[model samples]
Target: MKATRQLHDLGQSLWLDNITRTLLDDGTLARYIEEDSITGLTSNPSIFDAAISGGDAYDAGIHAKSLMGMQGEALFTELALEDLRRAADLFQPVFESTGHVDGWVSMEVSPLLAADTAGSIAAARHIHHKGRRDNLFVKIPGTPEGVPAIEEAIFLGIPINVTLLFSCAQYEAVSEAYMRGIERRLQAGLDPRVGSVASLFISRWDVASNKQLPDELHNKLGIAVGQQTYRAYRQMLASARWQKLADAGAMPQRLLWASTGTKDPDASDTLYISAFAAPETINTMPEKTLHAFADHGELHGVMDVDGGDADAVLARISAAGVDIDQLALTLQREGAEAFVKSWHHLLDGIAEKARQLAGKSDGAVLK
Candidate 1:
């Protein structure tokens, strides 16, 4: 069986960590849902920036909005919502089938607001309202400043994808923040079943520690970090605190493996997909990795909840002069900055498309 199918059958949801108008219009996303077991999707500024700038897929939306005096973020967010709403419709059945545990599509708030907590909260709330889709998750960075936003967004009944986490500690912090938000809901006599996913970046760890490690340890950093985080995730799930939340009708905030694309050309493309499968967690892959898994991937078994060998491996990497904790901070900062760059590029791309499609609004390029 395809590894993607295997993961789904094992109860680990596989989400495509990408979305483009082309995918939706071309029926590629639909095929993934039917054939590859892709139950959800996620998009960031970088992905949106690439989709808009690298193609003419969004020309009509840009032209229509431009005629309405929208530009910059105001224009881009609306265009993104149009795409997300369509994507959400495609996955709504899966969502209903799974009782809201799967079949989600994520749209991020402006990376420009990563450091602004209140702005992030307000933006998340606004986007949640605009998208008006039950399956939509507002992507928020897991930065220190963004934690309060995550909690507030969750408490206010907004689904969230907690992105930009690069370490086990970061994942746990966001998990705790999620619980706090749910706790608030429970205390206020609200429905405590707010959906959320804490996204842990995988390949970036390997990329960050690659130069500092020996040959054997070159591509191992990402998976090791994932193992450690998965261990923490299991511990949290079975802990007394989490059980209390679960009893209160609060859902567990799934731990998602993100950035699963292999950075090293010589490495196997399925490295991240097959290595990190665990029940109840999620693994969101880029299209290349997802296709590779569907083509020829292997899964020995799901991740060991006890995190076998993760500590030894992480210790070895650390002893090799790789400060993993400090490095996590740096990688997250870089990720946030990169997203900001992509966000600006996305706005610029939309503006350019709006200019080009000023009078030629009779089309759907992605279709």
Candidate 2:
């Protein structure tokens, strides 16, 4: 069996962490689902920025929207929804078969609202409704401010993909918010089955601490963090608190591994993919990493529920003078900033494309 199929059989869902008009239009996304076992996809400001600025795939759409007087972030959201709605349709089978747990396409709320609790909540609700697809998740950062927004959106029955979480504590914070939202729903006589995922960003831990580590400690921090977070996730799912909600029909907010692509060229390309494999969890990998894993990835074993060696690895990093707690905060902040940067660049690309297309139309009309 191919490694992708093996991973699926072993109980992990492989989702492509990319979406481009070209990928969807050229049937590549569908081929991945049919051939490589990729059941879902995810997109962010960075991915969309690359897709819009890197190719002409979006030119016609941008032109049409431009003629309709749509520009900036509004224009970008429409273009993204166009792709996500199509991608969601492609994954509809997996979604149905899994009872809505497996196939999901995530679209992030505006990164500009990462620190604005009310703003984030409002944006998430708007985006989720705009997509108009039950399988679509509005991604909100697991920032301090975003936690409240997450709770609100969940209570409003918005499926969420909690992004930018870097530690077990962060994951737990968002998980609690999800539970609270579900509990609120139950109290209000609403359905408690609001689907959500707490996205733990891997790979960045290694990138942030790689230079400070001894050679033995290199490339190990991220997996260690993942192990710790997964331990928390499993425990949370089994707790009495979660059991009560489950009895009330609430779904557990799944633990999703994001940023799984290896960063160091010297390391194994599938390092994160293999190390973080576990059942009932989702691994969203960049297309490059996805293809690399589909070709040669191995599932030696799933991650230890007890967080094997996670404490030891983390201790060593702490002894190496890296404050894990402080680092987590820094990474989350940096990630939010990076997203905002990507958001601005995405809008810039859209504006420029709209201008170029408008210029062409004017020229043609003159002729």
Best by TM-score: 2
Candidate 2 residue-wise lDDT, 156-198, digit = tens: 9999999999999999999999999999999999999888998
- Residue clash pairs of candidate 1: none
- Per-prediction TM-score, please? 0.96, 0.99
RMSD of each: 3.0, 0.7
- Candidate 1, residue 77: CA error in Å? 1.0
Scanning candidate 2 in windows of ten residues, the lowest lDDT window is 293-302
What alpha-carbon RMSD in Å does predicted model 2 have with respect to the real structure?
0.7
Off by over 4 Å in 2: none
lDDT of 1 by residue, 84-194 (tens): 999999999999998899999999998989899999999998999899899999999999999999999999999999999999999988998999999999999999999
